[model samples]
Target: MILPITIYGHPVLRKVAKDIDKDYPELEKFKEDMWQTMYFSDGVGLAAPQVGKSIRMFVIDCSNFADEEPELEGFKKMFVNAKITERTGEEWSMSEGCLSIPGLNEDITRPEHIKIEYYDENWEFHEDEYSGFAARVIQHEYDHLEGILFTDHCAPIKKRLLKGKLTAISKGNFKAKYRFTLAK
Candidate 1:
């Protein structure tokens, strides 16, 4: 199923998510739903909080950028209870967009490398390192688990300038190709 993404200003988006174990209700099903929703919405990454679930889970598929980063070809994975152990390398700026914050894209600065620990769908634990675009996408989705948004990393002036547009988005004034729910 393609879950309804929670729009900006949704309280769930601002709450820190909790870790879930293998026994999380319908864990396997939920993971599939996340992947379906993400692909359906044309998003490279989607976090549990974005779907109104306060859990440390997210999915990423970067195959779309395979031409630019051959290593990312067919790279798809689900991260559960993920934790970033380290962030190294120089920071770089990249334009980022979120399904939860539709119609708004911002140039966000993030580290170029990261070491993280997470469990895959099989419930096996794994610690991995990623770089470049993969690292950026991971960090972006990880922020959702921490109740942080890409816009929060923007310059002060940029944020101020976006206030009106953000408010409009919260009020359902934006158009998105996927289904979403506005804050009550």
Candidate 2:
């Protein structure tokens, strides 16, 4: 079922999510629910906190975007208690937006390449190295697990300028416009 996605000003979005306990048998179901929530929301990624659950787990499906194609074979992935094992090379600037902070995109700098270690649906450890848009999406969701939002990494001036707009949107001032835009 599609879960209600928490908005930017929600406290849960700022809270550091708890690590997923491997012994929890229901995590597989949770992953399924997250996937449904993300797909229904038309989001490329969704973190547990976005659904009001403070857990270090998130789902990613890059296939939804028409412009970007994931180089990896296996597309949809769930990361439980995921961590970045290594990040190397120069940082690259990418325009990023968040499910929590809707309608705003900011240029943020991140490592060009990253190696992430995470547990799959079966609770098996898997390590994947990624770059480009895929890496940016994973890193963005991973930050949610650590109580970090994309705005936290945004350029200071850009973020400051968007503060009022963000607040207004959160207050439902832009609901009508948002609905129309989302319809497209």
Residue lDDT tens for model 2, 20-127: 677766776777888887877778899998888898899898865535554644567889889988988789997887767777778899987899998887789998
Clash statistics: count for each candidate: 0, 0
Ten residues in sequence with the least summed lDDT for candidate 1: 20-29
C-alpha-based local distance difference test score of model 1: 0.95
Q: Which candidate number has the best lDDT? A: 1
TM-score of 1: 0.98
What TM-score goes with each of the models? 0.98, 0.86
Native-to-model Cα distance after best TM-score fit, residue 184 in candidate 2, in Å: 30
Can you give the lDDT of residue 87 in candidate 2? 84
- Give the clashing pairs for model 1: none
Report lDDT per candidate: 0.95, 0.78
